[model samples]
Target: MKTNEEKKALVKQQYSELALSADELKGKCCCGTKPMSPAKKVFTIMSEDYSKLKGYEADADLGVGCGLPTEYAGIKEGDTVIDLGSGAGNDCFIARAETGESGRIIGIDFSPQMIERARKNATKRGYTNVVFIEGDIEEMPVPDNTADVVVSNCVLNLLPEKDKIFNEIYRVLKHGGHFCISDVVLNGMFPKEFTDNASMYAGCIASAIQKEDYLSEIKKANFEDIKIERTKTVVIPDDVLKEHLDEETIEKYKKGNVGIYSITVTGKRP
Candidate 1:
């Protein structure tokens, strides 16, 4: 198994390279699911209504998120929002509209290439308040008690040290500040059949623990009013599973062994 630092480096390299093209990214990422793939059905349950919101830049969304955390983030004008793992500034742009001209936004991602692309997109739309920075979410460059709100989507599940990320969120948020993030969580850990698959880890499968555990950690970090805003069972297609496991292993997995869910959860710093 790769160490945490190694995993972070690999994630950075992969996402940075994927930043080169949206078309290629959609087809190549997440256990190799293609556009119109059955795997996409997982998003239909609680998908983001991007049309209802405004300030979207072209090519900003590569459709990487499983749920739209920004949809329930409750951002207001003049609020300072921090977007963790903000890719291509998709959620950041949405948050920008809620924050309005008087507000500010800081989008932090470990991928330098993603930061470059996000900055370029922000500049294209003449967005002066949004700033994309290359930084680790677990150890952000942001100041303590600074952010009014924090948001992320589909990115937190990829991190190996989630407690650190949440702790950072707790520390950076103002006393009344809160976070709403979307991520994949499991009913149980994967069996050996899936745990050994590196591609699954990169696809946000192998890394997830139980949903209860996920919530408990957030509460442990001193976040209050924790609640799941939305949920969807991400059903992996038979065709997609065929790429990773044999028929026998797949059949065994079908017998109520594991369940993967995409959740948008909200919490407040008390």
Candidate 2:
């Protein structure tokens, strides 16, 4: 078994490769055979409604979110929004449209490649209201109490320091500012072996925290009026599993032991 440090390092390596590879970017496993197209399809379906917003189409092809944060953020004209883990800026593009030319949107992500992709997409779409920055979500470089709305999509579970992320989110948002995030959540504890699996963790499956624990952490960070606005089960297709996992692992994943789950969680900093 790999040490925790080793596991983290391996997962990081896997995702670093994923960021640049078109196949991996399309949600395929690193092995280059098994299709994760179903996962990508699900994300696309959920975010289809946001395509109507300006600048959204340029970023949509790069999106890997399970739900739309803009819908729940209640964004309006003149609002300043911050998107953590902005990925390819799908949410940023949508938020920019909602805020219009008079408003602004700042998108931050740790991955330099993703930041580059987002910036290129923004330029291609002539989005003057949106800016992409390279930074970690746990220690955001933005000014304190500056954002009217903060959003993240299917990205929080990748963090090892989740408490710090929530704290940073609270610190950056204005009083009464809202946090709307869509992320994967675990219904129950994952076995140690599974939790420690590098491929699984990098795939956004193994790192999920239980629903109650997720809420408790946000509350501890002092976010109030917390609520789960939506939940959806992401079914991993049988064919994909056969291509990716051995028989033993396939059985483990089938019995509700492992699957993608999505939840839209909303809270306010007060």
Candidate 3:
């Protein structure tokens, strides 16, 4: 079994590769080795459509998000927003549209390649207020009470220690400030074999914890007015499950009450 640090390192390396290949695989989901046949959109189940949105930059969209956090973020013009795991500045750009020129947007990601790509995208759009910083979300470099709002999309589940990340999020936001996050959470635990795979961790599967535990962490952090904004069921097809599990494990999964869900949640930092 990989230690906490080892799991973090593995996630960083895989996401770095994803950022390096972002341009080539612009609209492709990073779930499987090969794209599932069109009949089965299993791998693409987590991603949402962003083409119609204003301030939508195709170059910045990596097609890895499970939900649209910005949609429920309640951002206002001239608010300072911080985006964790910004990934080529997808959510940052969308937040920019809402924040307008007076607002500031800071994107933090551990992947160097993702930071570089995000910075380039900001420059291309001539947005001086949008900035990308390379840093671990668990131990962000930003100051206390620095953000008016915090937003993240499909990134937190990749880490082994979610409590620390939530505490950090709380520390960074002002008293009335809130956060909106879209992330993957499981109804129950997967098999040990499935959870132990490093690639599955990066693909936002193995690293996910149960929904109840996930919500508990938020409450433990002293956040108030917590609410689940939206949820979408994600069904990984049988063919994709076969890649990781044997026939018996697959059958158990099918018969069990296990489910994967993309949930958008919000909470205020009191």
Candidate 4:
């Protein structure tokens, strides 16, 4: 088994490559990373539609998000918002629409390639208030009590030590400040091979924990008034399953109690 640092490095490397080719490959990728064979196109099962949202930028949309956290974020004008794993600034630009010109949006991402691409996108749009910083979410370089709100999209499950990450989120927000995050969670077990695959881990499937555990971590971070805003059952295509499991196992998995869900949850630091 890989160590925590090794897993982090693998995730970082995958995302770095994704930052370069996501736009060009478009629908060919799954969960924003893990490029499939060109002959077999992999549809994105995690991303929500962002094309119709206000302040939507086509170049900024990498088709990686599992849900639209901004839709349920309850952001107000002039509020400072921090987006964790803000890839290419998709959610940042959308939050900017709600926060308006007076508000500040800080996007923290560990991938330098993603940070550079996000900065370029911001510059292209002439947005001075939206800034992308390269840093680990588990140990953010931001100051305490620095944000009015926090938002993340399908990025937390990719990292180990989710408890530490949630604690960091709590530390960054002002008292009574809230957070909305969209992430993936599992309802049942997966085959050992599925969990062992590096590509599957970065694709946001194998790494996902139980839904109950995900919520427990949020509460453990001292967040209050936690609620699940939305939940959708994610259907992984059979072809994708074929990459990991044989026909018999796939058939059993399809008939079994297994379920993958994309959930958007909200909580506050109090």
What TM-score goes with each of the models? 0.89, 0.84, 0.92, 0.93
User: What local lDDT score does residue 11 receive in model 2, on the 0 to 100 scale?
Assistant: 45
Candidate structures ordered by TM-score, highest first: 4, 3, 1, 2
Question: By lDDT, is 1 or 3 better?
Answer: 3
Model 1 per-residue lDDT tens digits across residues 153-182: 888888889999999999999999999999
- Model 2 misplaced stretches (Cα beyond 4 Å): 1-12, 23-55, 58-60, 256-260
- Scored against the true structure, residue 8 in model 1 reaches a CA lDDT of 74
Residue 75 alpha-carbon offset, candidate 4, angstroms: 0.4
For model 1, which pairs clash?
Answer: none
Worst 10 residues of 3 by lDDT: 35-44
Evaluated against the true structure, the overall lDDT of model 3 is 0.87
What C-alpha lDDT, on a 0 to 100 scale, does residue 124 get in candidate 1?
A: 89
Best candidate (score: lDDT): 4
Estimate the lDDT of model 4: 0.88
Model 4: per-residue lDDT, tens digit, 141-199?
A: 99999999999998999998899999999999999899999999999887666777777
Model 2 per-residue lDDT tens digits across residues 1-270: 666446445545654554576435553456767655643332333333455656566434454577877888888899999998887777888888789899989999877777887788889878888999988787899989989999998778876667989999999999989999998888755446556655566666667788788888899999999999988886655654454456776666566455457899999988
Cα RMSDs of all predictions? 3.8, 4.1, 3.2, 3.3
For all candidates in order, the CA lDDT equals 0.81, 0.75, 0.87, 0.88
Residue-level lDDT for 31 in candidate 3: 73
